[model samples]
Target chain A: MKNIDILVDNATCLRGDNLIFDNISFNLSNGEILFIMGPNGCGKTTLIRSLCGIQHLENGCIKINNVNINNPECNFLENLVYIGHNDSLSENLTTYENLEYLNKFDLSNKDEFISNPNKFLKFFDISKYKNYLVSELSQGNKKKVALSRLLFTNKKIWVLDEPLSFLDEDSKNNLIKLFLDHITNGGLIVTSTHIDFSNYFEKSKYLNMKGININE
Target chain B: MNISKIANLKYFYKHTKNVSKILSFITFSLFIVGIFWGLYIAPKDYLQGDSYRIIYVHVPAAWLSLQVYIVMAVTGFIALVWKIKIMEIISIQSASIGAYFTLIALVTGMIWGKPTWGTYWVWDARLTSELILLFLYIGIIVIYSSFTDKRQGAKIAALLAIVGLINIPIIHYSVEWWNTLHQGPTVTKFEKPSAHITMLMPLLYMLLVFNLYFVTVLIKRVRLGIFQREKNTKWMENYLND
Candidate 1:
C-alpha cells in the first residue's frame, strides 16, 4: 500500500444561490473503492469536481494526504487522476495524437507508451480507430479512447465523474475487471455514477448523495 | 489569506475589491491629466504643425494595441498550463481590447498619414504587419468563440496567441528592416528621444495612462466574467445581495 488518503472535512458547496451540499465529510485511504451514487441534480458531479481540484467549494476544506487542498506546496495533483464530464481530448487530433498529448505528463515508464498503444486499444476493442481523428470517431468510440487514459496513467487516486457514461456493456465489464485489479494493488478509486455495481462487485463502498442535509 | 481563491471564479470576486478600486482611481486620474497635458500644454511639431497633436491618441493606441496582444498570450499560456479559470477569462477579454486598440491605431495612423505621406493607405511594412495583427486578433476571437466547450476553445486560442507572438518583433522592427513610409523609431531605444522634450513628455504620460486604462478595464471585465461563470453557485446569488 502506498498510503493514499483523501480527507474532506466539513465540506460545503453551493451552486449559484442553491446550496448543493453542506457539512459533508468523508475519509478514504489506501486500496479503497467508493462509488458516489446520487440522482440527477444531487451535487454528485459538483462534489467530484471539488475533490479533483477543478471546482471550488464555498466554505470547506479538503486535505490530500494530510496537506490542505489550498496549500501551494501540496503534491496532491501529481498523484491524482481526474476525468471530468468534459473529455479533455482535442477533436482535431487523431485518437493516437490525443493519447500522445497525455504523454507529456511526467510519469515513469512513459517510454513504453511510445507510438500506438496496442494493449489498451485492444482491450477497449477500438484498435481499428486509433488513426482516426477524435471528431470522426463515434461518440462511444471517443468515450472509450478517453477512458483508456485511466489505464495509461499510474496515479494513486482516481477521481472519475461518470466513468460509465457511454461505455458499452463488454467494455464496461473489462473496465470493472481492471478496476478490481487496480484496487487490489492499493489504488484508490472514487467515482460518481448512476449505474448499479451490486451485481458485478459487492465489495465496493457506496456513498449516497442527496444534496445538502438530505441524508440518503 | 486563501491562496487558492485566485483560481476559482466565485472566490476571485471576493478578492477583487481592493485591487480594482485602487487601479480605477489611479488610471482615471492619470487619463484626465495626460489628455489635458497632451492637448493644451505640449508644443506643436515644427514640421507637421498642430496636426501632430493626433499623436496623443495615435501613439498610445499603437503602443497598447501591440502590448495587449502580448498580455493576452501570457494569460493564455497561464490558463493552459495551470488551468486557472480567471486566466482563461482574461485571455478572451484581452483579445477584444487588443483588437479595439489595433483598430484605433490603424485609423489614427491613416488620418496622420493623409496630410504627410500623400496617401492614406500603403503597402508599407509597418502598416501591413499591423493589419496582419488585426487578422491574428480576429483569428483568436473566432476560434475561441466558435467552440462548444469554452475550455477547449481557450486551449486552441492560447496556442494561437503564443504562435502569433512571432509577429510582434516583426511589427516592431519592420521600419528598420524595410524602407517603409512609416517613420523610424523616435521614442523606443537606448538613445535619447529625437522628438522635442515637451512633446515626448506628454506622449510618455499618455502611454502610462493607456496602460493603466487597460488594467482598469481588465479588472472590470474579470469581475463580470467571474460573476457569469459562477451564476450556478449560491455564493454568486448572495454576492449580488451586498
Candidate 2:
C-alpha cells in the first residue's frame, strides 16, 4: 500500500462575518476514512471545500503526503477525487459527453482512464441513460452519474460532500460498498454527511464540526 | 515587493490601501488640465482648424483601447502561467473597460472622419482592426459570463485574451502596412514627434490621464472581484467589518 497521510492542523474558517469553525485538526492515512459531521450551518461543507483546496482557511495548514496544501509543487490535486454538493457535470452535455470531457480535459492521468466510459456507467447502473443530457437526469440519477466518475478515476483521496443526500437506500448501500472497496484497496476518503456510517468501516475517524469552538 | 505577495488575494485585499481614490484625483486633475490645454491653449491645425481638436479625446481613447488590451494580455499570461487568482480577476475585469475605450475610439473616429475623410465610417485597415478588437473584448465578456463557474470562465477568458494579443501589432501597423484613409503615426514614432510641440504636449498629457483612469477603474473592479471571490473567508469578513 502506498503511504498516504493527510493532516489538517489548527484550521480556522469564517463565512462572511460569521465564524464557521476554529482550531480544528485531524489526521488520516491509507485505507482510512474520516467522516466530518455537523449540523446544517456548522461548517461541514466549508471544511470539505478547504480539504479540496476550493476554499481557503483563515489560519494553519493542510498537508497531504507531507506536502503542504498551499505549496505549488504539492501534487495533492492529482491524487484527489472530489464530488461537491453540485455534481460538477455540465447540464447541456449528455452523461457520456460529460464523462468524456472529464477524460479528455480535466483529469491529469488522461491515458490511464478507460477510453470507453461504458464500464463506469455500468458500475453506477446508469448505462441505459448514457445518452441522456445531465439536465434530463433526475437528481438521484445525477448524483449517480457524478458518482460514476469515481470508478474511472484512480485518485487516492476521495472528498465527497453529502454523497448519500439524494440516493435511495439501495443506491446508498451500493455506494457504501464502493467506499469499502476503495478503502480495502488502500485509498483515503474524507466525506461529510448527516448520517453516521462509522460502524461500517474498520479504520474510520469522525470529526463533528459542531463540537469545535466557534470563534466570534 | 514579492511577486507572490502581490498575487496573494488576501494580501492584495488588505494591503492595497485604496489607492483608487488618489488615482481618481490625479486622473480628474490631469484630465481637466489636458482638456483645457488641448481645446484652448494648443495652436489650431493649419489644415483642419478647430475640428482637429477632436484628436485630444480621439487619440487618447484609441491609444488606451490598445494599451488596455496589452494590460489584459499581460495579466492573462501571468494568471495562466502562475495560476494567480488576482491576476485572473484583473484580466477579466479589464475587458469591459477596454471595450468601452474601443467604442469611444471608434465613435470619436467616425465623428472626426465626417470632417476629415468625408464619411462617418469606412473599410480603412486601422478602423477595421480597432473594430475587431472591440469584438474580441465582447467575445471575452460573453464567454466569461456563459460559464456558471466563475473560475473556469476566468481561465477560458484568459486564454482568449492571450490569443487575441496578435491583433495588437496588426492594429498598430495597419496604417503603414496598407493603404488607408486614416493618417499615419504622430506621437508613437521612433524619431521626434511629427506634430508641433504644442500639439503633441496635450495629446501626451491626455494619454497619461486615460492611463490613470484605467488604473483607477481597474483597482476598484479588482477589489470588488476579491470581495466576491473571498466572501466566505475570515479575513474577508474582518475586512468587511472594518
Which candidate leads the pack in TM-score?
Answer: 2
Local distance difference test, per candidate? Answer: 0.79, 0.83
- CAPRI-style grade of the A/B interface in model 1: incorrect
Give the Å shift of residue B43 in candidate 1: 4.7
TM per candidate comes to 0.61, 0.67
Tens-place lDDT per residue, model 1, B1-242, is: 22364346666688877889999998888888988898889997767778888989998998898899999999999987776667888988899899999999999988987776767876556566677789999999999889765656777898899888976686557644663334444212213336988999999889989988898888888887777666665677787787
Clashing residue pairs for model 1: A15-B232, A15-B233, A15-B234, A16-B232, A16-B233, A16-B234, A17-B233, A17-B234
lDDT tens string, model 1, A35-129?
88878988898899899777667677899989987788987888887878777789999988887787566353466667448776788898889
Local accuracy of candidate 2 as per-residue lDDT tens digits, B118-155? 78886566677788889899999999999876777888
Model 2, residue B171: C-alpha shift (Å): 7.4
The parts of candidate 2 lying over 4 Å away from their true place are A10-24, A39-61, A69-186, A212-216, B1-29, B79-93, B141-159, B170-194, B216-242
Alpha-carbon runs more than 4 Å astray in model 1: A1-25, A40-192, A199-203, A212-216, B1-44, B70-92, B147-167, B170-194, B208-212, B215-223, B226-242
Residue B82 CA displacement from its true place in model 2, Å: 4.5
Sorted into a CAPRI-style docking class, model 2 comes out as incorrect
